[model samples]
Target: MQAVMKNVDCIIEVHDSRIPFSGRNSEFEYTIGGRPKILILNKADLADMSCRKQVVDKLKRDGCSRVLFSDCKHDSTNIIKKILPSIQELIHDAGRYHRAENRDYNVLVCGVPNVGKSSLTNAIRHKYLRAGKATQVGPTAGVTRSVLEKIRVCDEPLTYILDTPGVLAPNVRNVEVGMKLALCATLQDHLVGETIIADYLLYWMNRHRRFEYVEHFGLKEPTDNITELLVPIAIHSNKIQKIRTSEGRYEYKPNISQAARVVMAAFRTGKLGKFMLDDDALDSLSEPAVADNAGDARHRS
Candidate 1:
């Protein structure tokens, strides 16, 4: 990436909008810094759009100048259009000493795993050049094995983008952060366990008073008990698994694991509802002094 950075004109760091702060590769600050960078929060359709202002403000204060919400899966999110103009504006205003003579734009699409880096790339490609998918899109992490060759997304000014493999942070120490990343499908479902992820989803929605899951999942009401949620779903959906006891006798039982996966799949596909996983962090923007004090303490420690 360092070698390719010389020819790259701008950087677009894509992240799951559901978690604007969680699981972001902090190493990007040192590796992809000093260039005109745009923080593209993809999966905007699943995010809390109301917190857009606060998230953008917080990112700008953290040194990122531009932050855009995008939903590559939907046709209405013409965020692809905003991207081209924004890229032109950001590049035109910044110094391009290495490639000053080049008229075409070369962008680098990078971010943590499964945050729609390839989807955004394909969206932009289709938006401008009316082309098909430039790269493979997957639900799990580490799908793109390497930095791909430049894919042309536009022709007017001749824009090309190098889609790189998603880079997760070296240390994800916070359990809550890991859960959020898992819920967003940045990590594989097996990594965090489907039941645990479903439980977290229920807990988050109940805490936030987002009870759309209740109606969607045929629950009588929102409950903290994951077993209570899964048992009914498993029976209704017939998610049963054949289990063999220690005596070697086979019996059919409600497959809560498969039920949990159903819940996860619904949430991922936005069937549960639009969820802003980082609402607590976004709300803190209203109290900068408290955040600054915590920052100070961390720095001091």
Candidate 2:
């Protein structure tokens, strides 16, 4: 990412809207230098809109001056409209240094995995160029393996976006942060285990008192036990499989893995409910010591 920073006119950091305050790589602020930066909180459609203003205000307080909530899956020109003007203004203010003086603008789209970087790239391409998808997009993390060549998104301003692989911090700060990232599918599920991820989701939901999962999964009540939760989900979804026992007899068993996937899918697709996984982190931003940790990691230097 550093190799291409000199060529980048602006940095567009994409993150899951549900985790606006967590899982961000603070190192990017230093890596990208002083180039203008914008935070694209993608998957806004799957986040609780009631806390939208609080999210924006907290981001601004934490020094993210340019933040836009976006849902790249749907054709919403709001993202394009907001981003283009900011890019134009930033580029105009900071004249091109190394490149030939030209109208074309190059933007670097970056974020941790599975936060919709490719989807955002395609959305911009379709909106501005009125063209088809220029990048591959998927629900799994790390879809884009490496830094890709710039793809034209707009013709008038001659804007092109460089889509980079979802780069995570070398070390996650804590378990809660890691679990939140996993819950949002920013990290691959298998790396953290599906059951553990689901357990974290259950704990988070219960802590927030968002018990929509109870009715959604037909559970009598919210229980902390993951096995109890998955059993009913498996039965309801008929996600059962036959396995050979030690006696060499086939036995039908509830597919716990399959059931966990179902629960996660519902959360990811907003079937359960929209949530802000970083809801607790927002309050921490107001504390002086905590607020200091919210900015660029190198800020400590």
Candidate 3:
């Protein structure tokens, strides 16, 4: 998907604000290589607010001009206005250099599946066309290809809008890549390996955003970590009865889904504290497509 953008004069890279890092294509950096690019962090409503703040801070530190956190379903009049100047500048510069016969600017928008690229395009096109422009969002598991030839934007009749397929991590050849991808894709699920990740979360909350948790949950400082402090979550999960383990340890496995539900709810309700899972996390991951091309080119040469 990133390679395809090279043909365009400007590339708008879209990402889900909730899990920005996970959806990033490893090959994208190599493709853009610091070209004129716009980073759109879509689906902000589903994300943790603290995470959004951290992302905004990182982008500001990096001197990025275009950064927006918006849900696709809501009105985006302001965001559209913000993007207009940049897109116009790109088109203007390209037009100035082109001969009379060749005066078209291609603006390409690309992003991962379910990141709300289609909805964004519709919103953009509607604002430009001043009509009810409609675009369909495809399914998560499948790719939907559609072409709406030329969409007039700001009276620029030749701007072409292209919607591409979602890009997912290619199959890992070994455990190394698999593990790396897993770490990139999912947060440390405090529910899966309960005794382990729960402990980590507790430690993180206490050390980093201590005040919020204490005041909000009314939680007492634990002598240990989450595994040692199951009373609160256990009660929340309605685990009325606690039994002794076969080896003589207290066993409490609250409702299987309770922990996850709680964590997600707390995150939604502003209880888990503001956190960012994308920005720096995204900068740390491997750039996509670098591992294959160099070797193939050398062999061919």
Candidate 4:
């Protein structure tokens, strides 16, 4: 991150607004330190608007640098256009004053998993005439691999971009959370594994959602509680070779094996109703007051 920031005049931190906290790589903050940065909240369409409002408010109080909401999956070029000129100026100044070499300014695009970093890169690549380079193409045709990738959008008026992987934080618990992050590394297009886990939990939450959970599992009896219904399901599915509950009425064994299968299925499919693991309010940081000089130093000093 530090190298990218040092290489580029401006650093844009892209993140999924739905899971801001999850998407943020705390380490990057230390790497970039206080370099001129723009916080981009991507996938705004999937996130909660009220929460984003709060995050915007909060960002303002925390130095109010710059924040933009975007939907990379859709048309979000307007926001990029608004921020581009100032960013270009910052790069130009860096190349002219800060750097000793006659090279173009680099702009690093850093973000967490599935936040649309690649999509955003493509968007910017389309606009700028001198766009440096679109992610360095590897030897393999059509197959893409992640390795601190970079793209050149322009030549004479140079501006390079580095696309980073999803941020990984220690605070992130749950194996499912990790699996979701796996979307960054794996080639699979669907979040099948995450959905399987989610479907299981959702099954418990809403029994009606999955007919197999109750019908094929012999849980049709209205009197059967969650555990009771689960045991037979697990036994029938061969998840457990054998089943033996405690002999006494005082003891009851809840069925976890069945739940495990459900969880496993969620992971196999991205069926979990567009789950956003991160707190949405992280974007509520207030907008910083617009710079007074519209002509000068819009993003960097």
Candidate 5:
């Protein structure tokens, strides 16, 4: 990442809108210091939009002056329209040094895994260049394995973007944050265990009193025990497996793993309901001193 930092005129960091505050890699802030940066909260369509303004206001207070909500799956988003203009303004304010004589601009696109970095890149390319996809995109994380050469997305201003692989922080702040990342598919599900992720989802939903999952999964009532909850879903969905017993007899059992995957898929695809996992974090932003202190600690680290 440092190798191309000097060449970048602007940096666009993409992150999951559902986890606005929990799983961001603060290391990028230090790496892209002094460079014009924009925070694109991708997958806005899947996030709870009731507190959208509050999220934007909180981000600005935390020094992210330019925050845009975007849904890269769509052909056109207002945020996509504003990106080029915003970058142009930033470049004009902070004149390029190495490429001062050059008319074209190079911007670096980066973020953690599964945050729609490549999707956003392709969306921009389609919007500006009227071109096909320039970068590969996938449902799982870490699709772009390495930084690639510049891909032109615009012609009038000759704008190109350097696509980089998703890089996560070395250490997640806490177990809850790690689970949140896993829930969003930012982290590989196998690494964290499917059942564990499902458990966290249940815990978070119950904590917030969001019982949409009960109706979505056809459960009569909510239950804290993951096994009990998953058994009903497994039966409802006919996700059953046959197992051999020690006595050489076969028995039918609930496919808990399959049921867990179903639950996780519902959460990710918003079948359960739109939610902001960082809602509690945003609420805490009301206290200025607490937010300031947390921001300072992240910068220092």
Candidate 6:
């Protein structure tokens, strides 16, 4: 990524809007070195849009001024319409430096995994070239293993995008932050147990008073017990397994793993409800940083 940044005109960092204030790779600042950077908080449809302005304002105060909320998968037109103009504006404002004579633009699309980096790349290509998918899009993390060849995404400004694999910080600040990353699907599900993620999701929802999951999943009411939630979900979805009993009879057992996955998928697909998972962190925007961890990165693994 460092080598590629040398030739890149601008950097477009895509991130999960659900956890906008967390999980972004902080190393990029040193790698890109003063080049124009645009933060695209993708998955806007799955995030609580009511807090959109607050999120943008918080990010800008944290030195990320060019933040744009995007739902690349569901609504591409809105972002595609603003992306090029934003890119041009940033590029010109930054004076283009060595690339001033170069009429074409090369943008590096990067972020932690499963945050719609490829989706954004494909969205731009579709809007400009009217073409199909240029890079593979997947729900799992690390789908794009390495930096890919540049592909033209626009004709007017001769814009091209370089799709790169997601890079996560080596360590997270705490367990809850890790859970947030896991819930956002930036980290592999197995790395953090599915049920654990579901529990965290439940805790988060209950903490935020987000009860849409209960109504959507047909639960009687909100509960902290992971099993209590998954048992009903599994039974309703028929996600159960048959086990041979001692007397040769069969017993139906809820597939908790599968049920946990169902819950995770529901949140990812916006079935549970939209969320601004970092709402709590926004409160610290005005507070001074902790002394001991002054340089500690907020980015998650």
Candidate scoring better on lDDT of 2 and 5: 5
Cα RMSD, each candidate: 4.4, 5.8, 11.2, 12.1, 5.3, 5.7
| Candidate 3 TM-score, true structure as reference | 0.54
Candidate 1 lDDT tens digits, 1-301? 8778888889998898888877777677787658899999988888768778888888788787889889888947677889988998889899787799998999998887888989899998988888898798987887888666589999988889999887545236598888998998888889889999999988888878889988998878789999999999999999988989999999999999899999999999989888778777765556556558777685465
For model 4, how does the per-residue alpha-carbon lDDT over 1-301 read when each residue is reduced to its tens digit? Answer: 5545556667877766655554355556677655677888776655545555567766666554578887655654477555566676655554545554846667777664445676677667766663443654221112234756777765646666777654323234555444444432221333344334434344433532334334433565443254554555455565554445576335334346455555444422333333344432342223345546652463343
* Global fold similarity of model 1 (TM-score): 0.91
Tens digits of per-residue lDDT for model 5, 1-301 = 8888888899898898998887887766888878989899999888998988999888888789988889987634567878888888988888787679888889998888889989898888888888898888998878888656579999989899998888655237999899999999999899999999999999999988999988888778988999988998899899999999999999999999899999999998889889899898776665466457777686465
Question: How do the predictions measure up, each by TM-score?
Answer: 0.91, 0.90, 0.54, 0.55, 0.91, 0.89
Q: 66, model 4: CA deviation in Å?
A: 1.3
lDDT of 5 at 209: 91
lDDT of 1 at 96: 82
Q: Which of 1 and 4 is ahead in lDDT? A: 1
- Tell me the tens digit of each residue's lDDT in model 3 across 1-301: 5555544666677776655444456566566655566778765655566655556665666655567765666653367656656766755554533233555656667765556667677777777777565556643322435432234454564555666555443334444333222322232233134444444445545644444644444566533445435556657667545669899998755653355345444644345554444433643433345648876675465
- lDDT value, residue 3 of candidate 5: 85
Model 3 misplaced stretches (Cα beyond 4 Å): 2-7, 16-26, 33-35, 43-77, 94-106, 112-119, 129-160, 168-203, 210-224, 227-253, 268-273, 277-301
lDDT of 2 by residue, 65-139 (tens): 888888987745376557777877877777767655656888998888888888888887887777898888888
Candidate that beats the other on TM-score, 5 or 6, i.e. the better one: 5
Angstrom error of the Cα, residue 28, model 3: value is 1.5
